[model samples]
Target: MIVGGAIFQLCWVVRDIAVAQQAFTEQYGVADWFSIPDVHFGTESAELRGVPTDYTISVALGYAGGQQLELIEPRDGVSLYSEQLERIGPGLHHAAWVPDDYDAALTEACAAGIEIVARGRFDDIGMEFAYLDGGSIGSYIELMRLSEEMKAMFDHLIPAGFTNPWQ
Candidate 1:
């Protein structure tokens, strides 16, 4: 399995994306990166084996130093994020890592005893991601692999922002 990209970002699912964003700005001094609508898929679209489901949601992205923070809020039915929010009340939903070989990484994670919680694409970003069992790691882990077109889009869009953390 592929390794070594490092923790790329952290996500938090909240009841209200705007409220969470404000809280983050006040608590961590992070700035808003962007916000987008998203969808989740599963047996029932939002059902979790051990938690509740969080379906169609809105996410706000923010940046601090070299890491990103995502605030997710349900826009429709139940979803994984909604489940987390129900249990924990809007905080530290997951951590993300970038991998070159996503399939191989998933294989490795499974071999290492991590469950594949969900897998899907972010159409807006042209990227795909997988969420592994949080119970195993004490928190959820997300692995992202961006397509070439997505990388190009990010390269162009990110520079337009007020802060370029990677630089």
Candidate 2:
């Protein structure tokens, strides 16, 4: 899972991770940016376009005002994030959600015809997440599983500014 808080992060697809992180910090005064480079979804289990493909992406997380902002840079492969970046350039990619029941949420989403575009797991932290096509709501809704470590990290993501995230 990428984030653990109730108010999930807003993701932006960017071409450069360092540039985006710097922009967020300089333009919005968002600090404590936690970054991960080269996150790969393993083959066989994780499918991209219905086939096991090697997809890698880099991410930076920081709190702006009271909201969480994530900047994602697609590295190598063909995931939905990469596709969005290629089709529309860098912009708002998705809004994430951490549900109470992973399987139940997925089942409910499927029942509503909210298809799972991409799902992956990172065994290193027992973390897994899925990107659900927002059926009627529009865009993509990312559902992430909550890990203990992630929960701990998310606890620090509080209201950073006296005003709002955009400030």
Candidate with best lDDT: 2
Clashing pairs in 1: 46-53, 53-78, 53-79, 54-78, 54-79, 54-80, 55-78, 55-79
Candidate 1 on 41-145: residue-level lDDT in tens?
A: 544322355454546778777767656667788777666676776787767888887776778998898898878787666565667777888784677888887
lDDT of 2 by residue, 1-167 (tens): 42344546799999988998888888889877888899777695587645777788898888876677898899988888889887888888888877777788888877877678888887667668888876667678888777777665665565533332112
- Report every candidate's CA lDDT: 0.69, 0.77
lDDT of 2: 0.77
Stretches of candidate 2 above 4 Å error?
A: 1-6, 157-167
Among all windows of 10 consecutive residues in model 2, the one with the lowest summed lDDT is: 158-167
For every candidate, C-alpha RMSD to the true structure in Å: 4.0, 4.7
Task: Give the distance in Å from residue 123's predicted Cα in candidate 1 to where it truly belongs.
Answer: 5.7
Task: Determine which window of 10 residues in candidate 1 has minimal summed lDDT.
Answer: 158-167
